[model samples]
Structures are given as C-alpha cells and as structure tokens.
Target: MKSISSADKLEDQKFNALRLRQLTETNPSIRAEFGESGDNVAMLIDAISRADALSKSQHIWYIDMIEKRYDDLAENEIDDIDTSDKDLKRLHDDLRENLIATITSVSIHSDNIKKSIAETPDAVQLLVNAMHYRGREELRTTAVVAIRTLCSLDSNKILFAKAEKIFKYLTRMFDFRDGLVLKAAFGTILSLWSFLDDTESNSVFTIEPSVKAHVIKGIIKLIEARCFLDDVLEFLARLSIHDDATEKMVMYDATTCLFYVLRKNPSLHTKENCAVILHAICCKKDHRTLIEMRSEEKSRRTLSRLVEGGTPRAIIKVNGILERLKE
Candidate 1:
C-alpha cells in the first residue's frame, strides 16, 4: 500500500469539510452531533478553520456551518465557557469570531441566521462584549450588523430594549471614525429606537439623560455628511415618536437637512421618513409656525413627490401629514 502524503491528508480534510456541510444541511440529526450544546463544538470549530482556507465554495460552506451552529446553540440553554480553561476559551473565541464573519457575509438565509442569534439569550451579549472590548474594527462592524439584524424583528427589538448595556455600547460606537463602522452603529441605533413604540414598561427604550445630549450631537454630526443623510433622517423620524426627540431634531437644524436631502432626490423611504420628522416638528406648538414658514414650499414639494411616487404606506403617511398641515 502507498503511504499517505501530507497533500493527501489535506485533501481528505477538505473533502470531509464539504461532506460535513452537506450532511449538516440535509440531516438535522447529524447536524446536532456537532452543535454548540454538544461535545463536538471544538470539532466544528476546527473544521470551520480548515475550511476557511480552502476553495471559495468550501469557505461559503463554512459560513453556512457557522450559521447552523449559531441556530442550534440558540435553541439550547446557554452556558458560558470557563475563561480559566485556556483551550476552551480559545475555542469559544474562535467560534465567536467565525460567527461574526458569517453574519457579515453574503447569504440569502441571513435573516434566519440573525433570528437564531437573537433567539440565543447570550448571543447578543457575547457580540456586545466583543464589540466593547475587542478593538478590532471588523469584529465591531460584525457585532453592529448582528445587532441590527436582531432589531429587525419586533420581538427581538423588545428584547434589545431591555438590554441597556447593549444600547450603551452601540451609542459609544457612533464616535468611532470609521465610516462603515459608523453606519452600522447608526443602523443598530435605529433598530433600538424602533422599540420606542412599545408601551409596556419592560419594552420602553431608554437613553439615559446623561447620554441623550451626546447622542443628539453625534447624530447631527453624522448628518452633515451626504452619505449618512437618509439614515439620519430615518432615525430622527422614528425618534420623533417622542416630542422631546422632535425638539432636538429641530434644534439640530433638521429642517435644513431635510431640505437638502429632498432636493438631492432621495429614495421614497427617505422622503417618507423626512415627512414624518417634518410633520412631527410641525405638530409642536412652539416650533410649528417657525418650521412651517421656514420651509413651507420645500416641504409641500417634497410631500407631492412622495405622494406621487412613494409606497402605499408612505403615501398614506404623507397624505395625512399634509392634511394636518393644511388645517
């Protein structure tokens, strides 16, 4: 018999990696054998690591494996690895890093993967911890993406609203200089703000008074750039659900921001959100006339465009706000 060469061993590992991906996809029983709740988590991590260096197809399979692992872990009771156990901790970190990478990658199943992470009690906290202390931009970006994805669901939004520490960490990320990082942070904040509509005491989205002013300032600063214009508008629009938030948007010259964005031909969503913010600003007794006279023509024109070209929901919102303006 011929002796097996190192190349042969490497090929075998890659082949095994591909088969593992296939089996995991086709057979949940086999998949559970390598789940995060089982003893095979280390083996899964090892396979993922080896798969990453293989062909593009294998790398994608690795991402799928990571996503499935996250889903499986989400269904089981969470148990943190002992930090004192160096080997276990290393494996934990590796698994988490791979998870972040997979979350950031392109995939049609991203929403399902995100929901899985959101379902996991410790998963959001783990990502937050990594973002707060990891110092790596890529990891931080991934964490923000993961958080944003979680916020996409109403159930997850309520859950996140109760996670004060996660929101606090996300607020701090707004101060980061990286543009991509800033955008991701903004998206996460917007998601958190969506929780504001919840009336339940546990569902209230809280921004401590101490950080409120800082957050307002950070948002306005980000709005100065054209790239973040729509994001800022949408954030303010959602934020306007509270009168105080509307006041802050006006104080930050949001009218001016809206005027420019509308003129530049923003998307229907942006236009609709801008109308909401404007409507909210106009609803305030003190600020109403001032904003009305300041940009009356521009606002009307923007509303017309939205009415003509917006989505059914956007059309309804803008039309109602317009009637209110007319009154």
Candidate 2:
C-alpha cells in the first residue's frame, strides 16, 4: 500500500470542494439542501479546512523540492521528471490559484459559509496568499472579492481587522490597472468600516501614515475620475473624522474635488457625504481659508444654497461647511 502525499490530498480536497460547488450552483435542490442543512454546511467547511492544511504542507514540500533541485543542478544531475524551477513555480501557482477558485465557489453566497470560512484562519491564509501573488492579477482580484464577501459579515470583521498585513496588500491592490479590479479592491478596503461598533475592529487605517495618505489620494483620484463617486465620498466623510486623514485630504486638494462633485447632480446621500467631508476638512483655519480661496465660484454658490434646503443630514453638513467657510 502506498502512502498518499500531501499534494495528492490537496488535489483530492480541491476536487471535492469544486465538485460540490458545481453541483450546488447548477442544481437548485442541492443548493437549497446545502443552504438549509447544517450537515451539508459542515461537510463543506471540513473540506475547506482540510484543503487549507494540505495546501500549506504541500507548499513546504514544494519548497524543499526546489532546494533539492537546486542541489541537483550543482552536481550536474537531473530529476527523472525533467522539470525546471520555472515549471515547478508555475505548477505550485496553478495549484494554489485553483484552491482559491474552490474557496470562492463553495461559499455560494451563503453568510453561514462565509462566516465559517472567515473563522478558519488557515482558510483565510490561502486567500491572503493569493492577494500577495503579484504575478497574477485575476487571482489577486478573486481573493479580494472573497475577502470583501467575508468581511461583509459583521462576525468576521474583527477576524480580518486582526490581520493587519491584509491592509497593506489591499493598499497595494490600488496599483492594478484594471478598472473593475481596482473598484472591488478599494471597495473591500472601505468595507472594513461596518465593524465600527466592535472594539477589536475599529482601527481602519490606524497604522502607517503613508498607507493612510495613499488611500486618501486614491479615493480622491477615483472621485475625480467620477467612478464610485457616492461611495468614495462617503468613505472620505467617515475617514476625515480624524485629523490625520483630514490632513491628507487637504494636502491632496480633496476639498476642491468634493466641491466639484456638486456639479454631478448627486443624490441626497452623496450630497450629504460630500458636505460632511468638506465640513471635516474645513475645521482648521488654514484648511477653511484654503477652501475659501481655492473653491470654484459656481460650485461654492451651489453649496451655499444647500444651507437652506435638502435632506436634514445634508442640510446639517452643508450648514457646518458654510459656517466654517466664514472663518
């Protein structure tokens, strides 16, 4: 009897999970049963957990194989398989990315599945690895979507918040040239905020002044491009509550950008958030003076009129901005 290797076990788990995902997605009965039955959910979670462990062990094995291959090269010796280091690297990447597919698939948009996945740090580690895989954009994007879905669950917010390195990867995600990937990436970065009520989850950009500033600048650029205006405006609104974040927004001329958002026929919510961000930035005398001098004439007039009418939230924020503009 031959002992099965970790790589074989990993492939088996990945196959099982991917198969289950296909059946659940394509069969309504199976999907319903999987969603309703704790047993089915448990089975899926177990498969994912086992896969996580096996993949980690296989990563170690692959590394050892590479080192051995390097030694063999030194002796002018070759493996029977005739594989190169590049070939082995590609094989490992394919295996790992396929595992990411299995993960995203098996969840099937179930919160319970997402919660279970989020609770398992080992499972989360797989997605984190994909996020760090710079060579493949789609893999990193899928990992970001999975992370965004997991973080959407309030129960998992603290779990993600605890992984401070995830924030760094997320910040790097903005560098991608693909518009849709960039959108999902930055949106996921902002989605961590719904955990505000939890003590352990509240840090949201608490580390690294450079990271915080970059995020501010990115949001401003996205807003200037008129992509995801409402959401980015809201992000700046919440973010500017801190002096440090507001300082970056000011340095980047975000106040001018927020005022430009007024020309876009924004919703009341957008108007409120836009006003809120401006209000935050205007709290300082130099900042207020800057907005006063730098603001466009027509947009400033449009905002001034908002002091009289709009949603109560919008009116309040508008009032605050107008009052500060005087100082």
Candidate 3:
C-alpha cells in the first residue's frame, strides 16, 4: 500500500502539471492536445481516489484543485463550446461522484465541496438520493444544504425539479419534534420558496395546494414551538407575497397567529408589531372575515391603533389596506 501510495503520488504530481497546462493554454490546438485523452479523465479520478485513500491532507488538496478547475470552467465562455465531448462528460461524471461521496463521508466539514458538487445538475439529484439512502441525520442536513446552494446558484429547470424532491422530504421532516430537523426543515422551506415565481405559485405543475397547506401547518407549528420566530416571520412575509389562493390562506393563519401571540403576551406585543400585524390583516380583502371573527371591542381597538396611534409606517400600511377594503 505504501509503494502504491508513492506511485500514486508521483503520478498525481505529473497529472497536476498536465491539468494546469490544460487550464492555462489558450491555444485551441494545445487545449485539444492536452484535453484529448480518455486516460486524462481516468487519471484524474484515480488521483482523487488515491488521495482520498492515502492522506487526508492530500485529499483536501485534490478536492480543492477539482473545485478550482470547475470554477474556471464555469467562468469560461465554454457554454457555447461543445462540451458534448464524451471524454468531458466522463470526467464530469467521475468528478461529481467522487465529490459527492467525499462530502457525504464527512458532512459537516465538507460543506464547500458539497456546494461545488451541487453545481452539476446530475450531482444534485445524486445527493438528494444519497440523503434517502444514507438516512444519517447529518448527511440529510448536508444534502439539504447542497440542494439550497444549488437552487441559489443555478436556475436550471432540472435543478428546480430536484429541489421539489428535497422540499417534500424536508416538509415531512419538519413535523418531527427534533429541534435540529426542524431547523433544517425551515432552511429547506426558505430555499424552496426562493425558487418559486408568480407563475409557479399559481401553476398546477408546481407544489400542490395540499403541500402548501402542510407547509403552512409546519410553519405554524414552528411558530408555536417558539424556536425560530424571526425566521417564521420572514417566511410568512415572503409567502404573503406569493401569487395564489394559498397566499391568502397563509395571511389568514399569520394574522391569527400574530393575534394569538399578542393576546397571549400583551406586554411583548409592542405597539409596533401589533401595528404591523394589523396592517397585514387589512391588506387582504379576505382578512376582514378574520378581523370580524375577533370580538367587536378587540376589533375596534385594533382599528383605532391602525387609524390613530400606531407608528406612521403602520398607519400608512393600514391606510392602504383600508383603501383596498373600500373597493
């Protein structure tokens, strides 16, 4: 094994020099010469695997090199170039697989590599499947992170489709009583929300209403848990902007949640937060039903706060809602 390690080390040194030449040579002929061989791809993967097996330090270096190489490739105008080359595809697949495998092996410390792995559409689904295959909490969490990072970086339709699978998994996990799972679930929801557009929010092809309802329920449960109130608030704020009937439903629950939170602990419900909720409530025409559900005196008091004593910002938000209400 030591001799194999030394041989691998010498081979890797030569491979690194060739790889650098491939990256730096701008001449098409030179690039073609350096990039032509099936052996180059095989050697790169072999070097990565040997590094993984031998020394942790060398493994990190090889992974870092692979990441930088990919970043360089992405920065190229090569999107127009025919990377349909079989050798290139083989190299891509090999690198992606080893990257994902390495990431899953040491989930926490490999977040950067996980992020790089996610750059490939195929790799995103692979990680999503690995999450199910491993079922280790840390691995699942890492997979969620990878999915989110990919969603952030790439608007590729296939990546978004992969994200749907991750979203469903996380939504289910959110119901767990475990705090860490709940946190990961919240992060996943935010990522899913980030990818949604007006059309998708309303489109039959996107997340179903039932799933949206379950997401709302999960959010409400999280709010009740009092674990991530700020995140809950931000998520609600974003969902309120979603263009669908579900947004209205979310606003209704949010209004009720805010009311419950305020009524339960009157002192904490600063005039400012109360005013914001009041304004949010009035923003929706449907919210009148919710407001009417409140006792008359409470409703009148909320109205007064909105119309009179709340902050200027709150007054403005409420006034807008009132105008919408009149129509």
Better of 1 and 2 by TM-score: 2
Task: Give per-residue lDDT, candidate 3, residue 163.
Answer: 44
Candidate 1 clash pair list = none
lDDT of each: 0.57, 0.64, 0.49
Q: List per-candidate RMSD values in Å.
A: 14.0, 6.1, 16.2
Which window of 10 residues has the lowest lDDT sum in candidate 1?
A: 1-10
Q: What is the lDDT of candidate 2?
A: 0.64
Candidate 2, 1-327: lDDT as tens digits: 011123255345344545555665577666555555655544444544444454456567767877776665644445533455445444445544554554555566577877766665465665665687645576688778778767777777767765746766776777777787777777777766445423424444244576678678777777877877777787788887778888888888887677667766678788888777776777755645455534653445777655555678888877776665565
State the lDDT of candidate 3 residue by residue for 78-143, as single tens digits.
Answer: 443333333333333333333433333322223333343444334555556534532235545545
Best by TM-score: 2
Each candidate: how many clashes?
0, 0, 0
Error of 3 at 6 (Å): 22
Between candidates 1 and 3, the lDDT winner: 1
